[model samples]
Target chain A: MLLALATASFRIESSFRAQFWFKLLSGVLNVIARVSIWQSVFLHGAGSTDISLPQMITYAILGATTFSTWDATQILREIGADIRSGNVVSHLMRPYSYPVSLYARQLGARAHEMLMIGLPVLVVMGSVYGFQLPASPGHAALFILSLLLSIFLLFTVSIAASMIGFWVMDMLALEWSLRGTLALFSGGLVPLWFYPDAVANTVLYLPFAWISFYPLAIYLGELDLLSSLLHLLYGLSWAVVSAVLVALMWRAACRRMIVQGG
Target chain B: MRQSLSLYLYLIRLQLRTRLQYRASLIIGWVAQAFGYASVYGAIWIVASRFEKLGGWVWPEIALMLGFHVLGYALGALFTLVQLRRMEELVRLGTYDTLLVRPVSPWAYLVFSGFNIEYGGHIALGIGMMVWALPQLGMDWSLLTVLQLVASLISAALLTGSILTMIAAMALVLTRSRYLFGIYFDFWELSRYPITIFAMPLQFVLLSVVPLGYMAYVPIAALLGKPVPVIGEAAPFTAILAGPFMVGVAILVWQSCQRRYQGAGG
Candidate 1:
C-alpha cells in the first residue's frame, strides 16, 4: 500500500517538476534519518530502557500520512464548487463515478504528500535525532502493516466528511471544523498520551483514534500481535460503517437534487 | 485622517451590529473555542502538577504566558477574520477592485472590513484567567504594575496586528502561499513558552526573524523585571512602537504588491 501511494505521489509531483520525484524520495529518506537521530538524543537524555525506537518511527509516519489527508477537504470544496456552477452534471453523465474519480485524484495527491512531505520529515527526524530501530524484522513488518491500516482509516474518515457536500451547498465550514477536530482527536498535533486521562479515555473509543494513533502504537510494539489485530479489526469496522453511511447520504442527496431552474 | 478614522469607526460598528444578529451562534462558538483551549491548558496544568516546572516556567508564570498568548490570539481573531477570508475570495474573484474604488484608503477598508466580535468572548475569558491567576502569583496591588499590564497588552495587540497584516500583504502577492501562515502559527505555539528555554539560535530566530517575542515575550519579560535586550528597560514603550513600525512595513509591502496585482480573474 505504501509503495502504491508513494508511486502515485511521485507521478503527480513529477508532472509538476522534472526533479520533484527524485527530490521527494531523497527528502523522505532524509526526514526518516533525522527523526531517528532526534529520538536517539531524546533516548540518551531520558534513557532508552522504557521507549522503543521502531515504534516512534512508525507513530511519526502514521502522523505524517494523517496530516497529508488535509487536502481531502480542498478536493471536496472544488467538487462542491463544480456542482454549484452546473459543471458537475456534465461530469456525472460521463461513464465514470464522480466521487470515485475524486477519490482517485485525492489518493494520487495524498501519495505525493506522503512522499514529499511525510517521508522527508521522517528521514530528517531519523538522521538528525536518531530513533531506535525495531527489535526484529517481524516487528518492522508489523509496523508496516499497521501504517497501511492507518492510511485506510484516514481515507474512510475524509471520504465520509466530503460526502456531506452531496446535500449541503457549502461544506467549507463543516469541513474545516471537522478537519480541526480530527487533527486534535487523532493525535496528529500531540500524542493522545499527552491528553488528560479522562479525555483520552473518551476519545480512544472514537473512530478518530484509529486514523493515526492505533496504528502508530501497534508499530511501536506498544501492542502485541493480538492487540494489533484487534486495532486493525476496529479500524476496518469503522471503515465499513462510514462507507455505508456515506452511501446512504449520497442516495438521499441524489433524490433531493433540485438543479436550479436555468 | 479624522474623516478616515470616523469611517473606520463606523465600519467597526457596522460589523458589530451584523455579528449581533447571530447571538446564539456567537455564544456557542465562543463556548466551544474557550472549552477547546481550556482542555489544552488543563492538560498542561495537570502535567505541571506532576513536576514543579517544565523549562523553568512555574504554573503561575506559565499561566501568565497562557493569558498573554490567548489575549494576542483573541485580538488577532477579532481583527483579522475578514481580512483573512477576503484574502482567498479577493484572489479567486479579483474583487479587490471594489475596495480600490472606495473613497477611503483601500488598505483601511480591507483591514477593518470584517470584524468577528465573537472573539471578544475569548478576550474576556483571557482576562478572567489573568484576574484569577494574578493573586496566586503573589502580585502586589500597585499603580505601576497596573499601568505596566495595560501598556504591555496594548503593545501585544500592536505586535499581533502588525504580524497578521504583514502576512495578509504577502497573501496579496502570492495568493496560494497561505499555508505559510499555518507554518507561522507553529511559531506562535512555540511562543507559549518562555524564550529562555530555547537554544540561542532559535531564540534569535523567534526574537529577531519572526518578532513573535515582541508579541508576548518582551512585554512579559519587562513585567517580570527580566532583561530583554531587544526592548530594553522600557519594553512596554518599545513594544508599542514596534507595532506601528511593523504595520508601516506591511502597508508599504501591500502597496508594492498592489502595483503588481494582475487580478486573479478577468
Candidate 2:
C-alpha cells in the first residue's frame, strides 16, 4: 500500500503566501548570517566548517523554496471541509476521480509557484552568492527522480493524515501533529549530517528525508552517485507502498462517507 | 471594573464549556500541539549537540529565551489573533457590525467569543520548559531576580499583545493590501534564536521593527545577569517600562483604528 500506518511523512505544508513572506524575509536574514559566519571563519582563520558561508546562504535560500512540499493534507482538508459544508456531493457527482483531480490541481499550482516565485528568488541569490549546478548529468537525473517520489510520498502522507478528519470532523490537530513530526524528520532546516549519529540514522532513513534533504544533498554533491541511485530506488519502493495504502484508504473513507452521507 | 471582569470571565467560561463538550477532540488537539512543539525543541537539541555554544548561550540558557518566547506569544495569542485571523473578513462579513452594537468593547467581544484553549497548553509548556531549564543554570536565588523575571515575562506578553493588536487594527483599514502586513508575523521566527548571534544593525531592527528582542532576549539577559552589548546594564530594568508603554500604544492604535472605521463599505 502507498499509504501505510495512516502516518506517512514528507508531504509539503505552508501556503504560497506564507512562503512569499518567508523567503523574502529570509533573503534579508541570509545576508546577516553570511556576515556572522564569515566573521567566525576569520576569527580563528582556520579549521573549515563543513558548509561555507556562501554555501550556507544558498542552503538558507533553497531551504525556504524546498520546504513547501506537495501538501496533500491541505487538499484532503479541502475535501473534508466540503464534506462538512455539504458541498462534497458535487465532487462525488463529477465523472473523474476526486483524489486524482486534487493531486493534478496541486501539481499545477506547485509548478506555477516554483517557477514564478522560487526560481526568481534563486536567481537573485545566485547573483550575489554564486549558485552551484548539480554535480553531473547522472546525479541531476537521479535528483529529479527522487524529488518526484518525495512529492508523491508526501501527498500520500497528507492523504492518510486527512482521512482521520473523516472520523474526527476536525483535521487541525492531526495536521499539526503531522507537520511537527515531518519538520523534525525532514531536515528542512538543517542537514541530517549535523545531527548526532544515533538520531541522524533514524531520521535520515525515514521517508521525510527524501522530502528536502536527499534531493538537495544530491544537488550539493553531498551524496555519491551510487548511493544516490540506491536511495532513489529505496524511495520509489516507499512511494509505491504508500500509493497502494492510499488506494485502500480512499475506498474505506468513501464507503464510510457514502453511508454517513457526509 | 468588576462588571467588566465578570463579563470577561463569563465569556471565557462559556467558551471553555463549549470546548469541553468535544472532550476527546480537545484533549487530542493538545497532544498534537505538544508533538508539534516537541519537534522544534528536538531541533534545538540537535543543534546544541553539533555546536558547543550559540552566541555564548548554552542550551539551558537558550531554553530560558525560548520558554519566555512561548509564554509571551501564548498569552498574546490568547486574546488578539482570534479577530486578526479574519479581521478584514469580519468587517466584510458584517461580523464587526454585530460586535460594534455591543455594550462591551469591540476588541474584547471579538476575542472572547473566539477564545481558544490551544494557548493554555502553550502556557503550560512554556512554564514547564522555564522551570526545567532554571535549575540547570546554577544561579543563587534572589528575591529581586525572581521578581524581575516575572515582570519581564508579563511585559513580554503585553508587548506581543500590543503588536498583534496593531496588526488587527491595520487589517481593518488595509484589507486588499494586507498581505505584506501579515508577513510581518513570520519575521518573529528569527527571534527564537539567540539575538546576540545577530549583527548590530539587525539586532536594532529586531528590537524596534519587531520588538521581539524584548520578548525573549532582553528579559532573558537580565535573568542571566548578563548585560546586552552597547545597550549596557540598564536594559533589563527598562523592560518593565517598555511593556506598559507598548500596551498603551496598542490601545491607542486600536482606539484610533476603531474611530476611523465607519462600518463595512462606509
Q: Against the true two-chain complex, what DockQ does each candidate achieve?
A: 0.15, 0.39
User: Candidate 2 on A156-221: residue-level lDDT in tens?
Assistant: 777767766777777768777777877788876666877778888898788888877888787777
Q: Which lDDT tens digits does candidate 2 get at residues B1-266?
A: 89988998899899889988987778787777767776877776556545656666677888878888888888878776665667888877777888888899888877787777776667877888899999999987889888888888789778877887787787567553345444555556667766767768778887776677787888888778776864667778766666788989988988888878776665
Off by over 4 Å in 2: A1-23, A26-54, A69-77, A259-262, B176-182
Candidate 2 chain A vs. true chain A: TM-score? 0.78
- In model 2 chain B, the worst 10-residue window by lDDT is B175-184
Please give the lDDT score at residue A252 for candidate 1: 71
Task: Evaluate residue A119 in candidate 2 and report its C-alpha lDDT on the 0 to 100 scale.
Answer: 73
Q: What are the TM-scores, per candidate, against the unseen true structure?
A: 0.79, 0.89
Number of the predicted model whose lDDT against the real structure is largest: 2
Model 1: residues with Cα > 4 Å off, grouped in runs: A1-99, A162-173, A194-196, B19-52, B84-94, B118-121, B128-132, B171-179, B224-241, B255-266
**In order of the candidates, what TM-score does chain B achieve?**
0.90, 0.93
In order, what lDDT does every prediction score? 0.64, 0.71
